[model samples]
Target: MDIFELDSAFVLHTYARRKIAFERGENATLFDQNGDDYIDFASGIGVNSVGHGNGRLAAAIADQASKIIHSSNLYTIAIQARLAERVVRLSGLDARVFFANSGAEANEGAIKLARKYGQNSGRFEIITLRNSFHGRTIATLKATGQEKFHARFGPFPDGFVYAADTEDVLRKIGGRTAAAMVELVQGEGGVLPLDEEAVRNLAAELKKRDILLIADEVQTGVFRSGEFTASIGYSIEPDIFTLAKGLGGGVPIGAVVTTKKELFEYGDHASTFGGNFLSARAAYTVLEILEEIKNSGKLARTIGYFARKNGEISAKYPRLFLGEAGVGLMRALIAKDDLIQQAVLERAHKERVLVLRSGGSRVRMLPPLTISKEEIDLGFQRLDSACRAADF
Candidate 1:
């Protein structure tokens, strides 16, 4: 079957997907069905962390697949246990973890745990920030603060509210308040990052009130933001955090990490594919490479190079861009307006530089952690060429 045609015919029309059908990818570049090159600044929306065609990761997946692709979670999986342990160890956050299949599921698991934590206390509310996205499942959709995601979806589950500021969050805290969840850098909320000082202050208040804090790290986790998680960079230790996207390196996996080990009982939550051998092995491979990158100074070097190049892009195109909109490899060039943003996206696509349109007039880039300084420079140069060719 023709891949693109079959997808158009059979797949749900949920996404305004790009036209090109990507055939394969290498380190930081993707090749389309036409065999044209597109430097993958988007990184499959921050999922391909170590990048495409990673030999070790591929070999590990092949090796594991031959052994056993999956098994009942009823049986303790060694790979799952190891991945969870590795995540907690590297994060340096004393926490226990539960695995799931996607960020939405992870967020759902987090909400369930927080609610269960407050079940005895009679507090079950979860207040997320305005414009923050948690996930798209029913409960997670309710957890999301954007009205755009909530239209026609109501009579949503109660005990969910959105805070527009620190004061609003404080005001919302009451007898029923259970937790406040945030995305340190709001990915879909236009790639806008929350102020660290404000976040720290708010977290302190939550702690004072004995309320849990949940950091939705689906998009910003896995060294995309220069830390294992952006919450670490923020210097705020949350009660719970959700992980997905890059965790499985391309395989699907979601994890909910919590400080409270005794929050859930045996019957509280479960998943069929959660923590299965296939995804866990893939994620373990990603962690191995990321640890190497973090230790060998490549992670820092790549982030610094990206920041410097982005600074140059802004300096050269002051008229086209307003500023930068995020941190680390998960960043965006803030276009002056929607038209400018569209122009940058289209023109850059013409130059074979793949990027994404994020919330808040931003053109986002989520390059692989494995990307080199040379590839970063090449992406920016191609973007610049696109702009120049557009005579802007």
Candidate 2:
């Protein structure tokens, strides 16, 4: 049997698998088994920060693996320690770090930390924004705001609430509220970004009530949002921040960082493969590349160029395009409806550019940060072709 038949036979049908099966990738592009090239605007759903097959990242992983890979967290690992220090230093927050395997696990860790911090105070509730996407784990699923993901997955743990307005969030923060979790850019929610002023004001209010603010930077961190963290650009100093997706380039790694070390005590939480040497080396290399990009000012220039091109696309096709919103590489093009959005994505795929959908009517674009001007232009041309070919 071929790859598709093999997948259909054995794999669980959780995702609506795309037609093309990618065999290999190079910076900003993926190649299928047939050797057809597709410009990767999705960037593995915002995980490949430095792009595919980065030599430095590969060398780091190989070098670390040749020496040692998994030295359980029980002992002090040198690379892990160095990564923790780098994260704390670059975060501009006095915090401790706990590593995990994915975004869901990081959010799960953050939830546990919040619940423990508020256990004595009788505050166990977590308030998340309406339409926000957290994760797939039981705890993180409960923390998510959308009901579609909750189908048949119950009985969900209590103390989770959804709020749309700031006043509503404030009202929900009564005695039972432990923390308020937010995504600076709600990537899955149509790539929506919260207003800077609103986030700052909300953080201040949560501070007064002693409610921990958890920023889910799973999709928006690591220079995907122009800054190291979107919270930094928004000026919202969250008490706890969860990171994953792009932290280890293509490697699986997640982290929960907190300003308060007292929130987590011994035996409260741990992960076996969290900060293993291999993943730590990948993450460390990614951070180094990010620092170089920032220092060279290429990140800022690329972000500006992308935003301008998105604006041009929206302006050129006002009848079908609603608008665009988001920060840095985490952007979306709003279609007139879900049908139009689907049509555009399908056409774009045929045009050899890989994009993704956000919410119902948003075409999400999360291209690699290291993408070049020529690649960006090519992606834009393909997207334009898609827009023209789409029926609606």
The candidate that achieves the highest TM-score relative to the unseen native structure: 2
**How much lDDT does candidate 1 score?**
0.90
**Which portions of model 2 show Cα errors greater than 4 Å?**
none
Highest-lDDT candidate: 2
Number of clashing pairs, model 2?
A: 0
lDDT score of model 2? 0.91
Model 2 Cα lDDT, one tens digit per residue, 1-392: 98899999999999999868888888898899999998999999999999998889999999998999998999998999999999988889999999999999999999998898889989899999888999999988888999888889899899899998555788787789999999988999889888778888999999998999999999999889998999899988899999999999989999999998887888889999998999989999999998899879999999999889988988888877888877899988999999889888899999999999999599999999999898899999999998888844
Ten residues in sequence with the least summed lDDT for candidate 2: 165-174
What is the lDDT of every predicted structure here?
A: 0.90, 0.91
Q: What TM-score should be assigned to candidate 1?
A: 0.97
Could you tell me which residue pairs clash in candidate 1? Answer: 190-359
Q: Model 2 Cα displacement at 98 (Å)?
A: 0.2
In model 2, pairs of residues that clash are none
